[model samples]
Target: MTTFTSLPPEITREILQYLPVPTLLAFGLTSKNNHSIQQHSLSSLRLGVFHSRLGGMISLMEATADRSCLHSVQMILPKSECRKKDKVIRNQNLRIANVVEKYTHTLRDLEIACWELQESAAMSLAQLKNLKRLSIRLDHPHTRFSGLDPSFWETAPGSPVWNLFTSKKGEKGKSALGRLQSLNLERAGITDYQLTKILESNPNVRELSLRKCVNLTDKIFKILAEGKVGRKLEVLHFTRCCEVEIDERVLDHIGRLLNLKELSLYGCYRLDSDLVKKLNDEQWHIEDLTLPSTPSSPNQEVQIDPEYK
Candidate 1:
């Protein structure tokens, strides 16, 4: 009765390391022996905790609290597109804070797609000094009521989450999350000013995405084209940012990223695809390029080409 799980633990562990999260989880549920393999592999788990199963989140967190190898977590909130009561969202945010506080030291990649962002959750994120990749997708049902005024695209004063990116008065220009290499914020209520500060803090960011952000102008792209930031960025996405007056200057700024491998400007109605075609013709080794389907059509299907000409 020789089986895969019957192999030596060392060999099993080595094989399990190559398996992705879903496969590993499935293997665990197959048999007691496989479950044992999964338990040991929790140290290097890339976990995804769904909103429907949040009641078990604490149990899962408690189980892995002692393991120093927890590397990534993706938290998806329930009813992300609909309105939720303030109290319920706050409580859920507290749970998020708990998860952040628990894995602060070991977590390197974290993604949270929720309806709202709260101060406690923001404050907890500030503690993850080792975090390398972070994605926050906030699909707020009511931006104005939540203190995110769309007209200004401003995170009001005392907003703890946005504040985390700001340098402390005495830090001599050090950013709170200085170790971030990849940062993605979708539909976030942030302005050019706050985003500039965030970019200034994380000088090593290679992948930057600001999708569907309402308040941005072309100024942010201009900053990205400058000095160290432009030189280091490998991926840049500014999709569906309707307000931005993206013209030749912004395209030129994006073109200056010498190391850029991926660029997405989908849903940018103002950007001329001919300019993108010109940039593509220049050929700077971009592996992924997504452009608007039409010159002024927001709903047009995006044209994605790895070797776009």
Candidate 2:
């Protein structure tokens, strides 16, 4: 009577690849045979910077080699809502780059949700050439969701992170993120100027979301509508950006987007849904428009067409 681990190494490796991280990790603890399989198939990793330690991170990074089918990598910080200490957060922020550099070859989707943008770590983004979906959410506990505080948009010197990939002419050569597709910067509190520079850099982007960014204004959307990248964008999400007061002019600009499929603008009281319906003179290929839900309204239940999905 032979056990599952008694199978050939190649056979065992193929079977173990389909298991989830926890199961694969558990198998590794059972026997040395399972450890090799776990090492090879360890493609994706999701861990909180504060919840885990550096030694564990180093071990995982070392394990990810040519045999490892690395697919996605996410390195997120503890949320500000949890009331974490500043010193702890700062230390974690500083160490993110060191941990990430270990697996630059395997990285694809990268997300960094923190109270403040880790400028140092973000500067090294160019190294991750295969990164496609980038989500950078910077939200503080005290920062109002309705509008951005002045301090959050302090980019007079310009953000090194924003400059990392956007510039065609790097000090050395072309940086990473040339092939990026989707970018979401919800609640980063970036101003129009910084947004403009970022858009200018990533011209091939298809999906764009700036949800809950307090400092952003209509200017950013206008730029998006008219720019080269703006034309190619298929999905646009500007939800809860109360400060982004858009009128018919702005709507008209957005209406020109030829490939826009989904438009989400929940909590944007300033924008008129009626105008959004009527402003389609150019006949944009829009499929769905998501708005805010209100119990006060007579039409309490708004159902999106199931076919749209």
Candidate 3:
């Protein structure tokens, strides 16, 4: 009978991939060789905390740290067992942020889906300086989001996330937001000032998506179309955002962007068909556009299909 550690490297990797996350961590602790193998073998790690409690989530974070080599992770926040009670969930959110800090060096892509995103998690996200993409979405509990989150980057005065913006060169250097190329915020009620700060912090960003956001007025869109980031933005997508009418003048600036390759306004209530046609004529570089079939009528309350695009 051969011991488990006696297996070849290929065999060991295959085994680790199949084992549950907790079991894999426990196995890694058996020896240094096993630990190294776990690090190299793990590529895509997705954890579902919806089944576990706050304490269990902490244990999971510790276990993941032990295994090592986490490149991409999507953590789903645990659903409320009692619905009304969210104390445990808040704790779990903070713990998840701590886990992110542990993997900050190695992680390139991180996605967090939760009911209510706590400030701790948002702060921790700002600390990451090596990530290429950061996506946060509010799925349950809080549907209408607030951009006050990234505002932490510019506001709060003394918070860590805020400090990172003006921070001098550290282990990661002055580039506080890291190598982030894409930032997607769904249902995040980000204000004009908040979005501007986000762009200011992340100058290298090229792709951006704001979906199901309620407060995205024309001012925000105009900011993106004419701001410094506008020159570099290649993909812009806004779905089911801004119930109020958006001026054609603001959207015209977007149409003139030479770098924009993809543009989608699937469910915007403000854009009429004529204006979209004018944009198509005025813009020479837009290759992908998701516009509504017809212009929205005044006082016409109709359901616009967000998935139409």
Candidate 4:
């Protein structure tokens, strides 16, 4: 029975991988050896926190600064506070921004859930040259504040956060991301213009997930399916994105993406039987296809026979 303290640093680090973020952080504080082990594991760490003790977590995250081991950080806001307005929330965001600014060079994957995204926060994240994956969960103003003025959605283009990734005035086009690969805007109210701008900048993306993004329309999908941007995309997950209706033409355009291997249309009720049949009959190289739970109607049955490519 080897105690954690008795194990070598390499062995200790391997064990740390299986532990939760908080457990690893706690173990790191036990001794200098444990701390070093934890630091090494930080590069592969993926944090998913619905609610955590902010002070302690921040301190731990900061302590691993020199290690520069973080690859992904997923911050899930408390469901109760998702729609509430509070200064503390802003402070917490500032703290996150501070951490990101200090270590953007090492961070690769970032996910944030917030009531609204400020320009400054986007700007801070844009500085991360190694970022490959991003996910943003935004609470719609309409859903959060029923009967709120519609004008609240209208913000000036030059706003600090808005301009963060956008080209600065009087400058040639420059992308904030250099190595981005996958982007997920689940439930985020991103406009077509913004999405195009991002795709144009990160053309090397391979996987794009727009799950539950009600704001996106068919036009956006048209652009994506055409492979005008994200030509290298191989996996597309458009689950529950009811706003974007997929017609046969759109499906045909998607089939043209020769490199696409995985297509997920879970909960997309707009996709009819014809489109499904076309996808099943097409001799494309798609290896995985995900659909929603079926209806009881016999006519709605879609039989996907397994055939190895």
lDDT of 2 at 95: 63
Residue by residue across 1-309, what tens digits does model 2's lDDT show? 988868887777667665765677788887786565666544344433442334224423432122333332334444452244455446556766675565465556665544455555665555666667676655333333223345653322224456555543346545446667878875665678867776676688898887667667788778887899888989888877775365445676777787888988776777676666655433654788775432257868888998995
The models' CA-based lDDT, in order, is: 0.67, 0.61, 0.61, 0.59
Using TM-score as the measure, name the better of candidate 2 and candidate 4: 2
The TM-score of candidate 3 is: 0.65
Question: Lowest summed lDDT over 10 consecutive residues: which window, candidate 1?
Answer: 151-160
Off by over 4 Å in 4: 1-89, 139-163, 166-172, 228-230, 292-309
TM-score, candidate 1, is: 0.65
Tens digit of lDDT per residue, candidate 4, span 1-309?
A: 867578776776666665666776788798887676666554343332323345224423432122244434546455454343444346446655765675465456666554456655676777777888776544233323332355543321222343446564345586687577877665555666777777877788888887656656667767886655535678888776665355444566666667877878776776775557556566655788776433468678677877935
**lDDT, candidate 1, 191-245, per-residue tens:** 8778888878778899898877767788888888885777899888887877747
lDDT agreement of model 2 with the native: 0.61
Instruction: Compute each candidate's TM-score over C-alphas.
Output: 0.65, 0.64, 0.65, 0.63
Error of 2 at 234 (Å): 0.8
Q: List the residue pairs that clash in candidate 2.
A: 126-176
* Alpha-carbon RMSD, each predicted model: 9.5, 9.7, 8.8, 9.6
